[model samples]
Target: MTSTVRRAGAFAGVGSLALVAPLLGWAAAVPFAVVAGIAVLVGDGPVFELFARPGDWEEGRLHGLIGFALAATGLGLLSTVEAMPTLAFVGAVLTLVYGNLAAQVVRRRSTDPVVGAVGFVLGGAVGCWIGILATALLNGDSGVAPAFVVFLSASGALLGALLRSVLFERDDPVVVLSVGLLLWFLWELTDPGTVHDVGIALAVTVAVGYASYALDTASVSGMLSGVFLGLLTIVLGGIGWFAVIIVFFGIGGLSTKFRYEEKAQRGVAEKNEGARGSSNVFSNAAVALAAVLAYAAAPIHLPVGDGTGIAGGIFLYAFAGSISTAMSDTLSSEIGGVFDRPRLITTLKPVDPGTDGAVTWQGELAGTAGATLIALVAVALLDSVGPTGAGVILVAGVAGMTVDSLLGATVEGGRLGNQSVNFLATLSGGAVGAVLASGLGIAAVA
Candidate 1:
């Protein structure tokens, strides 16, 4: 276990270094790549032992691990032909996956797709991070390269995967912090105007966190302090995507406070009277943050229909939809509870105002209205958003709200936690928005 811990820590550091060095040549990063490959290959042995749950592993030798190391070392030679560290890292990943699969075949092991993917991303990210960092440190002077964006985005995926992994369920909070910064350091290659972005998110988070604190929205103790800072950084990094989030915070925060006493009396009020902690924020906004990052990092263009393809795509719609979905759900639950008679969405049977899956006409309307308001606000902020995009946001919001209700009626608070439900709803809304935006030009021409 001690050895496993050391390996994990060292690999995590390697990933952090890789993230910081996107500008370096793949050739220069060969050494870092070799080390990371060895770390992962060796760590697999004890790491499997340390965190392995029942039915998690199969009989295997070090052959696959050796092949992975050799492949990485060979790919490092690609620096002679291609200077890009990301490319070399990609080759290593492909080699590692193939090697692992061949090992599984030889051992007759039953592979879990989820676990396989987790292993690839988690370990691959660390390897990639180190490779890029070495390259940049050894040969950098060109000011933030495009490879940095590629690294940051990859790191985000790795960060998300690590966060959601059950390996840390029983572990200390340090588990998250350790990997999170390593992944975030991937963005160091890019010199974004973070002061403005961070300032915006911090100013809002502090004000809202403080107000919620004063209003008993949640106990200050329950609030995850780190979540606030992390969220601010995410928003700041997302650039134009921050406006919709601000809209979400302003509206969602107020709705939670509205009729707080009545909600408490009725036993339907949000826990802590909607003074959300870190988990609440993450549940409601994490998907939105991811959408915004996707948009800002790589804007997906939709064809405006005049011959140029993907000229009209606006990922902002997806970002707005996620925020809209979160707000719609919040507004309906909070505002609707105060003004309308409750009806069970599943059965149409009257229920107490706070009953799970309960809905009110007033709440439904408020939810739709909230979605519309945010859709407009988001588009206005971006100086983008067509009639079709706006309408699609509204639809996605309503759809997500319904999904939330369905989850609440069945699994929420039990098999699926409230945070999980929120994440699913937001994700659904983002997908809907992206799909709709993809066809905006077609609809416009039609």
Candidate 2:
């Protein structure tokens, strides 16, 4: 048993590295070793605890390592070909840290190897993709940077994971994992280059599509719709495309939240419901397309201030909203789930946990506050867009609450196959908010 355990520990370490190898590259092994050594030296707890049991140690460890390798290898390959930017590198590091932390938390709680493996895979892939894209766009001199980025990123990942394990012990692993990955991906794509724009757009679209498919809730039709929208945004430009992606993330979160509640209430054998929702893809695509159309159809030019011309404003808007939505949703759901009272959205009356259209005062207030915070973030980040641009986000967030309520009260309750209607409603609300803000002379159109 002792020998098996030791062998399992060794395998787990190597396997985890292997899983991230594609994205991190073989050089990532150095960071992995460094991280593991630091973890051991700092008395960070047992490094081998990620495995399930002595009997299952070898398999479990191997699984984690393999996932790490895959993620690292993929990221490395993409970065090499695309020449990622510094921001992308940062994003990757963040994802790695957060993802591993989340996995550790889950493992401690459930002793489920599958969950841990999934968490690592998801986190690593997301981190790598984000880092590669960001680097490609931001770095003026890209060739030399990527070689060192992997090690630096690996170190960051270790820090993030350790922080999660040591600090926020009770936080939901799924939420943390998802948000970490999303941020990493977004940051990578933030730079303003034509090639970066196209590559990021394509990557986002593909990722969203795969997420939709993996979740199993999205139909083939809905996935196609998302892809079509993504393509359209790319044709339109970065601003438009990015805006759409943000909206999609928000909608997707809402849908997933609802589905999880429903599944739990039904006493069904709860599968991983996270993979089912496609609201993120739909909302994001819609926002991006709208921005492009706005730019194309409008007589006035909106100054984006990023040297990328008028389209920059649109991109900023989308990017801000997207990041905000992802953050807000994660915060709201994870924090609010623990709230003493969760209410329905429609009547403000307290209802059962899974009741459609139900709103808890706690949840409603929390959700609004969360959305507002995100809106503010969007405004603050895109300084070039002007204060009026911030106002648009505020209005959109407010309108999103109303739109979400309306959809939940009517369309969402009806269970019309997917969450497309809700997504569309939110998109409409955002468009209305943007239009009103523009018309009110709060901000000039680029």
Candidate 3:
């Protein structure tokens, strides 16, 4: 606990520096940088939690000193190379702090080299990009402006809290609120917040979530989580996208219930009848949620503006792939049990019905049909996918399903786990769709 406090303090200080880059130059950042450096350099305390070192005085002090030196060197380099040295320094310092912190924290979390490497790459990329942008913003800037400092500080703290929640500690309501507030902050940056818009989004999320629960589409816990993710989708994807999510819930929920007794007799029924829990929803929709975020971040040529144009955009393409893949997997799994015989994917030997990694011709066709159905629906409503994009979605969905089977036969339930595999399958499908769209010249470079 003591260490947690100290580590939190250090992270807070680092976050403050990063958050202030746009509003306050290094003039305002230098002191906080010093504080963060000192926090990291603390010879004893929670700082050691991150670096995966035993909290021994001798070893701790050496690591602390190294961390401090790295930070100082980063700041120095930023000041030398950037036109807006103050902002540049702050950005560079933040990049160093966040990236290194993420790498260390990830190392502590996982022994897997792949996981650690992925963490490092993502954290470093975000840090460096933010730093470079700050440097560019500093061009022609003369003095520090006090305006927006308070707001930006809060935003910074929110990000800090989020980093800790995701990477270091458990989730908190405060952190959740921080996410909402930051999202609100971003939304308000474009225009004034209207009660109508907020009310409608909330109402939609509540209605759909509650309806799902009342209708036994999900459990109570599932409803709560669904509301959260659903509301987030509204914020990120808008009403049209939210509609697609609902379609999935309604259809998938019904399918799970269909012939539930028969499936149960075969010992292939879904847990809790047809009702799903939070984990199930997340496994299916998380990648789609990420796709929505990626889409909103950049200006893309959406298929909505006109029927004939450049591709609907990477976000649209990826979202389609993700959703289609998830639906395909679901339909295939649920419908496959009706087939009397299944073949093992690896050896092509006959396997018991519903065996892990087993595939059937009937299941494959059902899965492809499901993907095509979802793709067509997206095209009709979202207006963001072309025929080519839809085809890519279908192909990727099939690929994701096949890969999921391969994984189910191997790493799943051992190293990767089922939920993790589901997320990966959707992610793989999204990636495939993205690549295919790009290769086909359907999506423009963003």
Quick one: best lDDT, which candidate? 3
The segments of candidate 1 whose C-alpha lies over 4 angstroms from its true place after superposition are 1-191, 194-240, 299-314, 442-446
lDDT of 1 by residue, 24-106 (tens): 44343465556545545543566445433223334333332333334444444443454434534432333223223332333
On lDDT, who's better, 1 or 2? 1
For model 1, the run of ten residues with the poorest summed lDDT: 94-103
Which prediction has the highest TM-score against the true structure? 3
**What are the Cα lDDT values of the candidates?**
0.56, 0.45, 0.61
Model 2 root mean square deviation, Cα atoms: 14.2
| TM-score, cand. 3 | 0.58
Taking all chains together, each candidate's TM-score versus the true structure is: 0.57, 0.41, 0.58
Which candidate, 2 or 3, would have the higher lDDT against the true structure? 3
Better TM-score candidate (1, 2) = 1
Clashing pairs in 3: 3-46
lDDT value, candidate 2, whole model:
0.45
Task: After the best TM-score superposition of candidate 1, give how far the Cα of residue 178 lies from its true spot, in angstroms.
Answer: 5.2
- Name model 2 segments beyond 4 Å from true: 1-235, 239-272, 277-280, 283-288, 297-340, 344-347, 373-377, 380-384, 410-421
